[model samples]
Every structure is written in C-alpha cells, then in structure tokens.
Target: MKFQQVYFVVDDSFRLLWIGGEWDESALANGGSDARSNEVLSTSLLSHITDEPTRRATQAMAEAVQDTQTALRIDYRCDSPTLKRRYLMTIQPMKDNRVLFVHDLRDAQTFPVTFSQWRHQPGADALKCSFCCSVSLPDTDWTPPEVLAGPHPDVVDFTLCPDCEARITEAVSALRDGRKPGVSTTSGYGPEGTAS
Candidate 1:
C-alpha cells in the first residue's frame, strides 16, 4: 500500500519549516540547480506549486485549517518539464500554530468507488480517482472526468481528461487510417501516441 509521498511542516504564514518523506532531494527541488534540502527549508510551501488555481486553493485550505484548527484535504495537479503528477494534500493544524502537510502521489487506478463520485455521494469520505487511479480535477485538461454525470452513483458517467481523451482520439484515428497506433516512449502521451 506504499505510495509516493512527502510531508512538511509549515508555519501559520505558510513558510516551510521542515520537509521529509519518500520524495528525494531532486523531486523536492523547486526548479533550482541547487537541489539540496537545506535550500528548500524556509521557503514558502506554495512557492513550489506552479499552478495558479491549485495554489489559491491550497492557500485557502491553509487559512481554513488555521482558523478552524482542523484538518483539510485537497486534490491538485502539478506539472513541470521534468515531472507531471497528481497528489492529495492533507493539512492538519498543530498546537504550536504550525500546520502539518501530507502529500500522497496517485500512482495506480483504484476501482469500486471513484473519488469524484464519492464526494457528492452520501456517507463517503475517501477521495480517489474513478478510473486511472490518478487524482481527479474538474476543469483541468490533463485530468478529466471518467464518469458521466448522473444522479445515481451506480450509473455515473465516465469521461477521460483532455490529455487522455486526446490520446484515445489519436489512437482511434490511427486505426481508422489503417496504421498501427504508436506507443509513447516517454511518460507523457505524445502526438500520434509516439514519444515526444
């Protein structure tokens, strides 16, 4: 049940006080040549997040955690030239006016109950991806909905994110054109399914 994860302690002002977990120094570096852990210390945790919408959401969550003195969870996506991934972040308020942040990377698709559907469903608390086990976002192109909209969770509609939808479209087009659908060599889905 081990997944790619990272954790850090942040002051009420969102300053990163400490960081540790499964993430390596390279993964923790914020696009800097100096990937040393010491360099990451004292930096604002939100500074490492490049997405505007996600960063704003994270800020709101941090504020709420501090105000209510309770824990909160949020799902977000991050992508850079070196990495593209989704994570679930949990924020817990500490007695010392600091917040503990836990980040769990989504690596595998979990079935049975999709995270998106569970949120709107009654009595469910766990959030997870519906199909690909990747984190789910509403408006983002990289991570799209896998289920169709419906009142019944059992009959939920499944939809792929824009990137995945595009990959499927390209593969289908290749088949229609009577050629083999290319396989991507890199981690991302490239044009015509070939490596970028």
Candidate 2:
C-alpha cells in the first residue's frame, strides 16, 4: 500500500520552523501528497523507526549544530489522526542556515507500533519464565495455585509479582552484604497430610 508523508523544518536551535504536511491543500496541489493511490491506510498506520540509532543521532545534532564535519540523521514519526506520518530528518551544514531534510517515509520499512509503544512493551524475546535458567514452576497446588492458575504474583508466597527476579537480585545483594536465608513457618503439607 502507498504511504503518505509530511516534513517539518528544524532550525539550528532545534526549533520547529515549518511543517510541510500540515493538512495544507497547497502541498496536495503541489503533488507532495501521499494519497495519490486510493489505498486505505488504517488508523494503526505504522512508523518508520529504529530507537537506539535515532537517539545517538539526535545527541550528535545537539553537540555539533555548528560543526560542518558532523552530520545527524533522525527518522521520527508524527502522531496524526488524519493520517500516518514518518519523517527522515537530516541535520547538516548549509552555507547560511542549518538544513534539515524532511523526507517522507512512505516506502521505508514500517513498524506497526510507535517508539514509545515499543519501548513500553515487555518485548517478544523476553525471559519466558522469570524463574531463570535454574528455577522452574511446579503445577502442584502445594506450591500455590497462583503460579499455575494464571499470570499473577499470588503464585509466590507474600505475593511477589516477579518472584524469580526478586530471588535473583536478593541473592546477589545478600551475598554482597553477607546474609543468610530466612526460615518459613508455613507448612507445605496438603489436605491428605503430605510433607509439611
């Protein structure tokens, strides 16, 4: 599907000078519109981005706004309800004023989520079980049903949300502070008089 685009000028001081695709009819008349094709762009339109690299580029821009030797490129998204917007920002030296190339990211690879949404998300390649490499979750009720019944902290006694993580960090910290494990008074026995 074809994607729409817009551009915003960033000045030497990192100020928003002018926006190219501000729902202006002039841009549409000038053939700068991405709506040439009748493709239906959904409300969940994507953003063209990579997080870490963009951060570094912005930092470089902050420090080297005056140096011709340094150049910065930032590809960011615009939060517009009317349409999806992605911009490729180029910060470089010009003879008179600092120039920012605001190219439309229509054909660029897109992510359905924005950068903020992606960062906030837990991630797909995360630790499947918080128990770590050595630990495991038992399905037995004696161990508590919360861990087995659903995704909740009640699985662990005292309701530790991330019992595995807590244990790992606590173990390391305890070793550093030279401490011993505490005893538990609660019995592990079942209704049939299993081991307590």
Candidate 3:
C-alpha cells in the first residue's frame, strides 16, 4: 500500500498560502471534495477546522512554532469508514514568517467490518476526539471506536478528550520551553485519562 503525504503552507498570520503533495487526492478520498486547493487557498487555516477544540489547539501549535521558531510533531488518526490511517504532522517554522505543515502517513489498516460514516453535530451527547478517534458517551470515559458495540451514535460532537488535550498541551509547552517534544499516537484512554 502506498502511504500518502499532504502538505500546506500558511503565512505567519495563519492565512493559507499554498498546498501540495496529494492534498486534492486525499481530500477527495476522505469525502472532502469541497476542500480542494482552489477553494481553500487564501483562507484562514482555522476556518477549515470545524471542531472548536481542534481549532484552538491548532492555533496554539502554530503560534508556538512561530514564537519558538521550532518544529512540533504530533501523531493523529484520520480514519475512514473502512480504513484506519495514521499520520505524523510536522509544523515547521519557515523564513519570511511562514509555517509549513507536512503530514506523512505512517500506517494504514483495513477494518474487518466496515462502519457507517458518522455525523458530527454541535451539542451532541456523544463526544469524539478529533485527534484520536475515540468516542465517549455522556458522563462516561473515552473508548476506542473500534471496540464499541453496535448502534453507534448518528450524531457526535468533535472535541478533544482529556488525555489528548494534555498530550497536545505538553507537546506545545515543550516547544515553548525549548525542548523537543516526543510523538505520541497511543489512544484508548481510561476514565482517569490513563492509557488503557
């Protein structure tokens, strides 16, 4: 299987400048036909991110890169209905106050059974982490969507779980403190935010 890569550049002010490397193909494959390069160019990077927590974390990461002039790396999952795809995202500071984001596919797995595509509606009872693909019911701990039994929620909210939020914060803080942050893609957090 060929692992695909996608990259985009943004000015210091977070305006989209350029995008390349399988971006259009990935978008089309991931049900993002409207996210083509022609349509997204010259827009705010935050505008493309629909999840509120995700937008905040992305802005923080970009700002941290600009402040420290250091690159930050994080691993995330962007799974489709039948495929589990892992990617490493590198946020690199560039000259002329530009930041380059490169996403490298690290792994892909085909699920034994296909899942129906989920819809994300604001204020939904079910919450899903945008980074980890974990799902949580109301007043419950996060659980991997793979292990979930039948009858998944038709509408779920996209947000970060506590563990993901902490990990992202740590990674950004390390950059701010002039330390290199390690990459973590591990999911499945327990009730207390411990890796299960």
Candidate 4:
C-alpha cells in the first residue's frame, strides 16, 4: 500500500511560504476551504499541529534549524478523528528558509507482523508483546506480528503492552508450577484461581 506525504516551505519564523504535494493539499482541504486558504496564505506551521507536545517538539526543531542551518528529522503521531496517523517530518534548511517533508506511516493491512519482519521505519510506533512478539491492535488486543507483516518489515518497532506483559508473567508462573498454561487472569480466575 502507498502512504501519503506532504511538503511545505517555511521561513525561519515558521510562517508557511509555500505548500505542495497531494497529501499536503488534501490535509489542508480536510480542515475546510477557509482554513486551507488561510493555511496557504498566512498560517504558522505550529498552528496545524493540535497536540501541545508535538507542537513544542516541532517548535524546538524549527529553532534548532534556525540556529544550526542544518537538516533534521523527527517523528510524531496525529490522532484526529479522521486520521490516526504517524509521520516522519524532515526539515532541510535553505539559505533563509526551511523545507519540511511529512511522510505518512499508517498502513494497517500491510504493516510488518513479526519482529524479524520488522524494520525501523523512521516514523510510526507500535505496542508489542515482549514474550510472544505479538503486536497490540488499536482496540487494546494483541495479535501475532506476522499478521501485519508488510513488504518492509524493518521499518516498524514495537513496545510491550500491559495486557501481554501480564499474560507473559502468568505463563511463566504456570510453567514453574508444572501445570498447563491457562487463559489470562482477566478471563480465567481471581487471586486464588477462583472464577474471576
């Protein structure tokens, strides 16, 4: 599956100078025609980012670009109602301006499913089960990594989620007790193996 990307040019002050790319225009349009026009006309880069932490991070990157006049890249996630997406944003400083490239990384059907199949793609993050190498879905359930294995496995990284971590702990306990491993605590039993 193909991912969307957007590009923009901004001055040192972070004001939009030029905006191009299919995704860029589409994103602006998604905000409504008035907002899109305003963005193209005079909006600041940080204005588009609703999340405070992401805005701060982007602000820092802009400041760093102004100081060093060097190119840099960062990753951030955007959780909009229409788009729960991750992006890799690259900033390249020109003589008096900077160019930003935003690459989208949200292809669920084709995402890498296994750790071996996974590659460190620069933008998105995922929750993984440390013991089983299964990934957590947005619904807070886990699935084997191989279920999402895309053509580029090496681009994504995974972290352990709480439910899977608990499952792993229970499995280890069952092994130590020489008993057949059972379902998770959430479903199987209470503290002393009483029905939950």
Candidate 5:
C-alpha cells in the first residue's frame, strides 16, 4: 500500500495535498486529499516548522522564475522540521502539473549536523569519544565553504570525546612530573628499513 506525502499548493485557495507516497493502495481512504481546511492538522507539523525558510526560498525562487515562461525552475533549501540538517529543494512548474523534490544535504553541506548531534547520534563521534573537542564546519565559525549549493552555515566546533580526554589528562599529569609525551623510535625504520 502507498501513503501520501504532504504538499502545499497555490490555487484559488491555499491548499495542502496529501498525495501519499504510494497512490495505488493502503491508506485512510476517507475522502479526497486536498486538505484545505482551517482546522488544525491531525498529523505532525514538520513542514510548518520550516515555514520561514521555505517562504524565503519560495519568494526568492518566484522572483527568479517570474521571467520564465510556461515553466519555473527554482532551487532552494531548508530543514527536515525534525532534523536541522540542510535540504536541497527544487521546484519545477510543468505544463499540466507542479513538482517539487527535497534531498538531504549531507554531501552537499560539509557540516550538516550540529555539534551536539554529531556527538550523540549512536556513533563514535563527539559524543562517544571524549577526545574530539570539536567539529570544524567551515564558514560557520572559522571558514565557510567556497560556494554552497544549499544554505548550510559553516561551523567549526570541538567536542571532547572520552579517550582523548583521558589522554589529555594523562599528558597533563605526566607534564606535572617533568615528563614529556614520548619519543619516536623508528627514524625511518620499519619491517623493510630496520635502521636510521
């Protein structure tokens, strides 16, 4: 069975369309899907959360597309309402219909996730590891990427993971006792080159 994804449309009236992901089967087939009512939505308001960004994006796109005839090509970005990562959204006006596509900006945006999220999302990132003091996202804090396809701010942050934190502590303790980290023994010596 298929479920409808939500979409906003501009017609005589502002409408919300739940043209579910799948159209052939399996859903609350109660009525037609032009969710055009002033009543509160029954489902989560994810899109609404990104209303500001979406509006700004659409405005900018509309301005650019005003000159285009028969079709409009617009590329914008926002968040997932649930996830604060970058999303690349494209809207195209077809002859008989309108289309929109949204994608995650992981590869597009170098640093899509937040420092806290990077630390906590079930991985060995900043959260699990205590040594990682930060994640350097360019342009956010230090340097932003040269040209961004999406609206991802460059951010550089450090989160201390556990092991690294322990190492730092140990190093500090050793320093208190007049000891340095350690010496490198292999001065170009390995399995093949066994000497200086």
Candidate 6:
C-alpha cells in the first residue's frame, strides 16, 4: 500500500486542526469518506474514534507525551481485502499542549486469499480492536480476521481487546515514567521492543 506519510494536528482539547500528506487519498482508499480532513476538522478526535477504550487510551498516550515532551511510537495494522498493511504512528508533543500524529507506512503484503469486503454493523455483538483489527466473538479469544473461519461479521463494536489494552497501558506507563517507548514489528499493536 504505497501510502504517502500522513499527518494531522490537534488542539489542546483534541480537536482536529489540520491534516496533510495524502490524507484524502488514504481516507478514500480506506472507505473513510466521512473522515476526510474537510469533513472532520474542528471535531473532537473522540468523535471519530468508535470505541471507548481506544478513546481513553489515546487520550492517555497524548497526555503522557505532553507531560514527558517526548515522542511515543506504536505499530498498527490497516488491512484491505487483498493487502495487509503495517503502519507506525508517532504521537509527538507540540507547543501549546497540542499534539501531532504522524503515520508512516512500515510494510505491506498481499493476502494469500482475498478477504471479502467487511461492512460495519451498528449494535453488533462482536468486538474488534480499532487499532489492530483483531476480532472477538461472544466466547472466542481475540483472533485475527484473516484466520477467522467464516466471512467477516456484518458489524462489530470497535474497541480494544485485552491484549491491546495491556499494550497501551505498558506504553503509557513507560512514557509517564519518562521512558521512551520502543518500536517493534513483532506485534501490530503497541510497543513490544525493549524500552529505552
């Protein structure tokens, strides 16, 4: 997925301020027409985030960055029907308590078998991580959508699974303690590399 490094800025209150770097192209390609910069500017970042846990975790990361005045990096997955893409997001502190989010494409590969297009289902019973795209059923463990046995669910509640939550907690804790979060390609969630 030859993505052009995308970046966006937020105000002290986490309101969308500006976005650049192929944002429109990426949004369109990822079925995010309503998420375009023009459509989302001035809105609360939490409004665009579908999951409560993700929202709270994002806030914690940003706050940690602000307090530590250091950049925090984490890897995540953004997949398409035929491609699996990895991205690294850096949350950097800026002057005036604002934050800058920079997303760089790390790697991409074609899926062995193309996944059917997934549609969002409001009020669905299934759970999915907005960051890693892992899905959890009523009683099943969090599993990658690629490994699921059947077609993707029509809708899923976008929230962090236990693993993702733990990852975020660890990363934020390191930052709050004035440590740099390490970068790792091993997991498509938060930092797994040795903290420095």
Overall lDDT per candidate, in order of appearance = 0.47, 0.32, 0.78, 0.45, 0.27, 0.73
RMSD of 4: 17.8
Measured against the true structure, the TM-scores of the candidates, in listed sequence, are 0.47, 0.30, 0.89, 0.44, 0.28, 0.86
Model 5, runs deviating above 4 Å:
1-14, 18-54, 63-67, 70-88, 95-114, 118-196
Residue pairs in clash, model 3: none
Deviation in Å, model 2, residue 43 alpha carbon: 27
By summed lDDT, the worst window of 10 consecutive residues in model 4 runs over 187-196
Ranking by lDDT: 3, 6, 1, 4, 2, 5
Model 1's TM-score against the true structure: 0.47
Q: Is candidate 5 or candidate 6 better by TM-score?
A: 6
Instruction: Show where candidate 3 strays beyond 4 Å.
Output: 25-33, 188-196
Leading candidate by TM-score: 3
State the weakest 10-residue window (summed lDDT) of model 6.
25-34
Model 6 regions lying over 4 Å from their true place:
25-33, 184-196
lDDT over C-alpha atoms for residue 180 of model 1: 48
lDDT winner, 1 or 4: 1
lDDT (tens digit, per residue) of candidate 3 on 84-171: 7777788999998799998887777898888888877889999977888788997667887788865567788888889889989999
Candidate of highest lDDT: 3
How should the candidates be ordered by TM-score, best one leading?
3, 6, 1, 4, 2, 5
Candidate 4: tens digits of C-alpha lDDT, residues 1-196: 4466667777777788876665333332112233453445457876765334335545665665556655554333322222333444455677655656444443213332222333222234554332233455455456544345332233333343455345544444443455554333322113342222
Write candidate 2's Cα lDDT for 80-186 as tens digits: 21223333334455544544444443322333432221111222222222111111234323232222243322122111124433543443344334454221111
Residue by residue across 99-183, what tens digits does model 6's lDDT show? 9988877667798888776655556788767667787888888888888877667677777777778878888898888765686
Name the better of 2 and 4 by TM-score.
4
TM-score of 6: 0.86
